[model samples]
Target: MRLNPYGEDPVRLATSLTTSPPLTAEELTARCVGAGVVLEQAATADDLAEVNVFLGRWLRVVEASNPQARAALLNELLAESSAYPRLTDHAGDGWHIHYRDYGLPVARLLRALISVGTALHLTGRGMHRLSRCELTECRNPFADFSRGGQQRYCSPTCANRDAVRRHRAKRALAS
Candidate 1:
């Protein structure tokens, strides 16, 4: 069964793209396809440029100071990118819901998908679900799709490093 693209997956994709952005349209298309996004149109230079712009706006949503701010930023993205939800089988996989108008360019499709997916994620989960890594040195954004919803670091490596640092600090204090 196909996973819900408008849930955790797009959030994860957003975080992935934000963390290590593609340098070219081809690279962007490769990454999106790897993340299960189907690109009906050819990826172009304009698509790359547009995606860069969209990512900047998406970052604001991630970095919002409060839920109200987050909602406002996200709403702006949704307004700019998404349309009324409709069923589509553009990839011929099956009839699935799309939050964008048909036949958009690659960048527009990504913008619409990511924006609406983020909205669904924040509303369905908690507003605090999207955040940067708690480790101060690594500020990579992440979507907390954990069952417990308590993810703090972007990766286990960062989490382990922080834990080690905390342990060392506590040991030093005791000594």
Candidate 2:
């Protein structure tokens, strides 16, 4: 069976958008396609504006202080964006389930895809799977797809930077 497209990929796309927001509709469309999303239509300026709005709300879900708060915030997105699961061959690879209505505009499609994908990801993985990078200087959001669910940084660069900082601090303290 094909890996569930409605889960990890959408969350990753959401994280990317939060990390480096696209400045134009064409740019947003490019980013989505790069992230493996099939936009139902060319992204419009409204789609660009509204996607920024949705990502702001999506960040609230990422920044929630606790699991309950996270769930509550994600649920609000779900309530606002999702619909009953429907089987789709829209991509024509094979039939699969989609958590949104087909033929939605780009922004609305993204809102649905990310929200439902997030719900699936958290439920299937763990509630703690969504988080910000641990490094103080780079607090970008990341989905913890690590098998152990122990991801603490957005990238190895951040992890290495934080480690070096800690090592230097310890050396200073010892000296």
Clashes of each: 0, 0
lDDT of 2: 0.92
Q: Write the per-residue lDDT of candidate 1 for residues 53-125, one digit (tens) a residue.
A: 8998999999999999999999999999999989877888888888999888999999998999999999998
How much is 116 displaced in model 2, in angstroms?
Answer: 0.8
Computed on alpha carbons, the lDDT of every model, listed in order, comes to 0.90, 0.92
lDDT of 2 by residue, 78-175 (tens): 99898898888887888888888878889989999999999999999999889999999899999999989999999999999999999999999999
How much is 55 displaced in model 1, in angstroms?
Answer: 0.7
TM per candidate comes to: 0.96, 0.97
Instruction: Give me the displacement of residue 108 in model 1, in angstroms.
Output: 0.3
Best by TM-score: 2
Q: With candidate 1 superimposed using the best TM-score fit, by how many Å does residue 47's alpha carbon deviate from the native?
A: 1.0
